[model samples]
Target: MSFQLFGLPVARGVAIGRALLVSSSRVDVAHYYIEPAQIEAEIQRLRMARDAVVEELETLQRELPGDAPAELSALLDVHVMLLQDELLGAATKQWIAERHYNAEWALSAQLEVLARQFDEMEDEYLRERKADLEQVVERLLLVLSEGGGGRGRAGGLPQLSAATGDNPLILVANDISPADMLGFRRSVFTGFVTDVGGPTSHTAIVARSLNIPAVVGAREASRLIRQDDWIVIDGDAGLVIVDPSPIVLEEYRFRQRSGELERERLGRLRHTPAVTLDGEPVELLANIELQSDAEAAIAAGAQGVGLFRTEFLFMNRNGELPGEEEQFEAYRGAVMAMQGLPVTIRTVDVGADKPLDRLSIHELRQEQGLNPALGLRAIRWSLSEPSMFRQQLRAILRASAHGPVRLLIPMLAHESEIRLTLEMIDRAKQQLREAGLAYGEVQVGAMIEVPAAALMVEAFLDRFDFLAIGTNDLVQYTLAIDRADEAVAHLYDPWHPAVLHLLHHIIRAARKRGKSVCVCGEIAGDIDFTEVLLAMGLRSFSMHPSQIPALKQKVLRTDTRRCSVLRPARGVPD
Candidate 1:
């Protein structure tokens, strides 16, 4: 029988392989009480398990490929921290001694409490931390149950490799941890599908880095997929066909070959400059979220990073903000890795969709009837919280000394906000100078995302050195649609007349001011819109690393002058 499932398309590719269902081992923990005499031994056993898990994670980190994405190493670091958490260590021991429970039982109890706390979190990103907590606890339980010797089945991935017998397999799981994915890094899995995780989840990021087809948020994929069942995964379309018939399989096989041929053609253009047919050069850059992404960006021929989102540094950890030094190290690392290419670092854009639990604003987030997207966020949040803003600004300033670094303020809508942000940057520079710190001259830029920001182009042009249009948010706000809400996702159209008008105005205004303009949003990566954007005088584009080659190919074939002459009118098809 033929059936299909839909999910969020994350990494792009196509794969047809037998299903390999890998179930999480966390739910199989045994629980029991312990005798008074066994309490000390149980505590000792817990300590040994913690030590062993830490050792295993450290070994995995060391064994990671020299060129592996930095996020993998960072994920390992988070796991190690969770294993050594004071709550997990101290509270579990307390539970064991006072409740007379065995080590595994005590650990499971504490994990339940922690999981409940994470579940209560309103922010989806923070709520996902529950999975990390479970992953760490599961590892400890495995170590304790197996006498601290065995590898706990490698998250059931070894079974996939053993059953396939040289045939490719698609892994289906409720969720996959970084460690589990690492175990199968050298395996013969052609793709993966998960019941959980969004486009920006760590698993999706890792899958993209490994160039594997992946579909996530496929609820119940693991529950429905049986081992060795024929399956087809289309990562580009977010479709999974199970027990596919001969006809569907043949169609996908044709698509798979077409995709491979196109990729091969694009691969040959990696070293080519993104210049138009008329010999005009366009600056092609990458929007990076991690230091490891910088390597991939450069490898894909990105001139530099046009948008380096710093928000990832603020997520997926316990309730704590990264300090100034930590922020500085991250910014400096990206700068150094770029090898002098310009790196635009955007300040924390948390609010609405992403809430930081450690900040006082988190308490305010609990207030009913609050619209996060419109509420205090981006530059608005930064201005409201001067101290935190200053810390990030100081870190960015210190990092500027390393190489070409630019400051990009997000969600700016008013002259007042721009003025305040400039004042804050000046104050940070003063603080740096007073401390006798050496810093390079960093250009300041503004993200023209808000509709108000797009309207008040003169104010921004008069203030900032350059401008970057974030079409993703601009279109959503302009069209009064929430792109993340699937109920209205179909209504979120970038080609809408209002959106095109706003993009045209922003690009023309920036050019009039003689300031560089770059598009660092999803639209920038869309090959269909490349000619339209070029016709509108957009000279720079920043997108995902994987998207560059294809866009560059489009750019090379584009004749901007011809596009301008043949540009479509409002409500007219081109």
Candidate 2:
């Protein structure tokens, strides 16, 4: 069988061999209905589905071929772990139990909730993670209904299939989840093309991690692509050509060869230092959310952990608040895993798009005002809830005893906020001291996420130990653009003169006071802007651990003095 599918470009250079075309026919189930109370039974039913998958994963692991591909084994490990991950399982169970929804319905409803929240997120990168979550849920549901006995094996049972020779199989899906990507047996899969997902999607991340050529945003690839069809996936150009002609195949083959050569050249850069043309050194650090990400950073040659988001700890089972000790353990592990490298943990900046289960949605809406970007959030929220602040502060302080730790107060618009945060830190330190607990002397810093904070950098230069520019929020707030609204996503440009001006001023202020300035935003990871940022006197950049290698490559090629020639539209320095 032969067919073609195409959409916006995503991955490039796809390997091809035997392909598996999964066909799904949508069912409009209006007649097969259950009672309202039956929803309760359905809740139990969904848990059974989860249990079934978990058991299937275990059974398959024990049954797979002794020579199963390493990629497939890695994928299996992720699936097994995902079946047990507290976040996904708990969220799924909650939706089913509380709403009496079917497994699919529960997954869909949870996606809707996360999508809505992410839709309100001010950070484009963080906001994009919602898509990853959606893809994961979608994959899980597919395996639940269609996969035989848990594995998506052809026999509806645990089985291992290998692609003949080195021909890569094309992966087609409506949405490929992280677990699905992890479950992929590398020998059977050469490239990936999906109907839903973006560059920031989990599928894309996995593809990139494995150096597999992939293409995404192929709206009809899942519906059109059949097993064993010749397909070309161009990642750099973001194109997918289905059932490519002989000439097209030849061209792409040449491109693939060229790409491999280029990649080898870039690979050698891993050993190079991120120095400029003038030989000035720049520190490239990785941003992380979990301990699992640390290894990736180290492998990528990142100097240290730059931004450690701490909100994951606060998000509890079924959206409830996690205990203080639970938060401490999470922070402690991340700090110690860094092996004494400085890890700056940004305090929970939940608000607007990200709601805390402890607070009512309505109350949050009110406190956030008409504009969330301009509303009560980050340090403001922590200031209002002293107890919450104290708990986190204490955990961070205690973790400092294990490794180098720094506390970053987000959305610091006024000096008073910094003072209050400092006061809270003191209280936490005092309490720990009185209780005879050992804690390290942690550095206190502030996030320049607000416009007021950006312009008033000089006022705050001496007030904090360090400054991290949160370009995502700072740009959104500065331009009065709601980044989460796809309708206006185009307007949320990080290169806007206004944003550049703010960054210039903030960096200048920090340099004047001899305080370290780092940017923990998406822009920091942009390979194209590495030179521009270096010229602007940026000493450090914090981004996803996955981005470390490429950014480091950029840094090593840049000349700090050459980058300095670039000037901001506003705030002309004397």
Candidate 3:
């Protein structure tokens, strides 16, 4: 009989394939204590392993497919940075010197220490990066286990299965590094399941970029499925079926064909304007992390770029943030790619989850016991580092000359923050004038992810040109539940009564003030809530580019006049 295992549904579509199992890396470790006299040799061994992983990551970066999503390359670069981080390997050397533990034992022990710190982080994105850390450590362990010579492939898993028939190979593993995931990009696997990972993990992100059907955090996916077993993967439902019955397989296969046809039909809507049946126009925009991703947004027929997460550009550069010219070129690339479409560039939002490359996670926690989400992040972090903050402002203002650009400030909760932020923008403009640089005017926007900001929308509208609702943080702060935490993730509801009321208030206030407001969160991408959002008076939505067509279809079928009809049933209030 076929059995089922469920996990987090990361991407869409159904895949029927034969299993290809990759073993877990956290195994077969020798934990004997080493003599003090042997400490130097053991430490050198760790150094060689770290260096080897760096070489491996660089090789993978050089070998990334020409068509690979640019974000994938950034992830690979992060892995190399992890290898160089003293927190990861340098601290382990301390264990060897003090406890006299073997290199493997010391490394794994250090991982446990750092993982606890990561677990305490408030940002879902940063918390999910623990998977990346584990994957990096796993690579180091692999090299040490194999006597300091790591292989091109991971865990001896083949790059491509021997069989490439109608039944594709499904990768089932404990975890996968983005680097290793890139290596398998051009392989026979059509879908995958991992024993670990959340929606925001780099692994899941890469899977989505590859357009592959995937499920992550299936605790037993690797242990239960045998090699070559017939399996069915339901990416939408986050389900994996092993040795599926013929009847069941046929059902999924039919559904798969139907999904393909539906996609083809939706593809026809790309050129159609997003106007509701009642003649109300809605703006559909794309949220991007990289300039190269702008092409994807254009391909999906986005009206503009809504959220350009600039932090990815600052990541994994071995402690050095990009300078103004480098940052300007990146912002310019996205602006130029949009070809007259406005691009909203949010300043780098780094906090506990997205610590600067040089920031020590352990030291910060020890020093402040800070909650990564509530601590220095977004506008707060930018304001704290005024020079770095000014560097970013100058770049965005410079990019505006290329085309329309919006300078969005994240996490503004006070009048003082608004004043300071505006002063900084004026300062950046002044600096540009002094330097004789060409720049253009930008529509400055405030991100309403902070409850305080949402509650005082009138104040924001008084000072800012527009408002962008970041529902991800709004929902997190409203419910006090971290979506990345497995224990509380189930309680992380975006449709909570409080969240709905908050959304209603923000949209209503923005409209009353005659200010443009757009929801640039995960909720904007979900088609199920389309009518409800419109019912709540929303006219603009920003989401992943892949989500544009379906959402456009939803808008086309909806009647703005009847949006209130979604009210009582969904518990929306006046």
Candidate 4:
């Protein structure tokens, strides 16, 4: 009997031929342990493999069709960059040489160390890159054991489908990395299932991008499916079927077709403006970490860039500060990519989530506090490290010469912090003037993440050029719920009366002060609430590039007045 598993709805395409079935198996945790000599050997092996992959990629670049997708080239470049990452290579080697342990043990130990590093990063995208790092390490280790050389593919489930026909749906053991997900042939594959992954996991992102039905954290969905078992997948609901009854199969076929038609309908709006029914205009901007992401956003029809996370430049790095030139390049790239659209780059918001180890090591900062989010981080961390903060500000000032750019300082709680930050910006501008460097008049803004920042909105509006409400932290702090904790994630509701009350106040404050207020949190991307946000007099929102089109379409259909008519219920006040 055959079974089917569902995944995130990426969209739909015709099934080619065969599908890949994943079976679950267990191994002891000790098997992942790494030792010293093993680490050294693994590094050596990885270097050699990296070299070979680089050469092959260069060759492909030279010979490939000029019109070939740039993503192919980008994939190869990412491989080269990973191999060159000193932290991954050096850190692993250090453990091996110092501890003299086996390769598996050493790698395992190093992974924990890497995880700690990831946990300290403030940028969500960069923080998520830990998944990529973990996947890379796994692949490198497998290569060494298999006696293969030169960037071999990931090992786990077999690729069961053929190119001539549709590919089989795939199921995986754990969360799939972006690289592995990118390698899937969308036309051949139907859908996928995994034993591990969450809504925000890389696998989910990939599944969404590819428009495939995917089910994650199925425990042992792989074990339940047999080879060649005819199955159906429902991506929207994240459901799966094992030897599904005839009725269910028929239902899925109808759903699959209807889903495809609906997407086709939505596809038309990809290039259209996201105006609302009553002629309310909403600005849809993209949130990005890497410069390359800007291109993706533009392709998706974003008006401009918002929430350019600058932390990726600092991650997996050994230096206390990224060089001014490097920062300028990153900033300039983003500005130019937007083709004159406003780019708001959040200054380095290092806190418990994003920790600079070298700086922390030298500063002797300890994560001993009971609550890390409230501990020294974001603006607090910057205030602690003046030199590091200055370097970033200087870079942004220089990069501003290229295009419209704004600096958004995160986690502002007190009026003094904003005053101090502006003072530093003045000093930076003065220093640049003295040095005869050309720069632009840049806008300074603050992220309203803390309740203190929210309460002092009028003061902040008076001080800053703009305000971007970070609902994630605002909701978390207000509800006293750590959204990271799964047990309490449910409680971290944005729709809650308290959260709505806070949000309304912030918007009203911004408007009263005649300053622009935009939402850069996940809430902004929600189709369900786009109207509500606009109704609340919020005309600007920044979200992931993929979210821009839908939000835009929602905006074009919604009338500002109609949306505003709906007031907050009794518990919530507008």
lDDT: worst 10-residue window of model 3: 149-158
* lDDT (Cα) of model 4: 0.67
Query: Total backbone clashes of model 1?
Result: 0
Highest TM-score, which number?
3
Off by over 4 Å in 3: 16-212, 222-231, 243-250, 362-370
lDDT of 3 by residue, 86-148 (tens): 898778999788766567767766776677688789999999888899899888887887874
TM-scores for candidates 1 onward, in order? 0.70, 0.63, 0.72, 0.65
lDDT of 4 by residue, 1-574 (tens): 5555554433323232222343222211112223333555655655665455556557877787889899777765665576568876676666446644334434545665666578689999889877666666565555454544222223332322232322244443444434345445422456676666545444554455445666666656645544444556555666667666778767777776776676567667767876667765678888877787788778777788779878757754545468887998999998998898889999886654445545454244343435556678788888887887887888899989999999999999997898899998998898889999888989999999998889878888878899999887888789887544434434657788878888989998898888889998877877888867876789889887766666776777777776666765424465
RMSD of each: 13.8, 15.1, 14.3, 15.3
User: Which candidate's lDDT is highest?
Assistant: 3
**Candidate 3 collision pairs:** none
lDDT of 2 by residue, 104-172 (tens): 545544555556577689999868766555545555676556633222222111122341223455666
Tens digit per residue, CA lDDT, model 1, 1-574: 7889998887888988977564344444443455677788889988998999999999999999999999989889999998888988999999778866567656765775676578789999889978888888888877787894222242334422232144577888877654356545566778999887666455665576566899988887876665557999999999999999899899999999999899888988888888999998999999887777788888888999999988767764556778899999999999999998999999998775565655556446547655567787788888988998999999999999999999999999877888899999999999999999888999999999989999988889998999999887898799887554444555768889888888888998899889999999877887889988888889999987888898999999988888886457543233
Which of 1 and 2 is ahead in lDDT? 1
Whole-model lDDT values for every prediction? 0.80, 0.66, 0.82, 0.67
Kindly report which residue stretches of model 1 are placed more than 4 angstroms away from their true locations once superposed.
Answer: 7-11, 16-230, 245-254, 357-370, 570-574
When sorted by lDDT, best at the front, the candidate numbers are 3, 1, 4, 2
Q: Once model 3 is optimally superposed onto the true structure by TM-score, how far is the C-alpha of residue 200 displaced, in angstroms?
A: 6.9
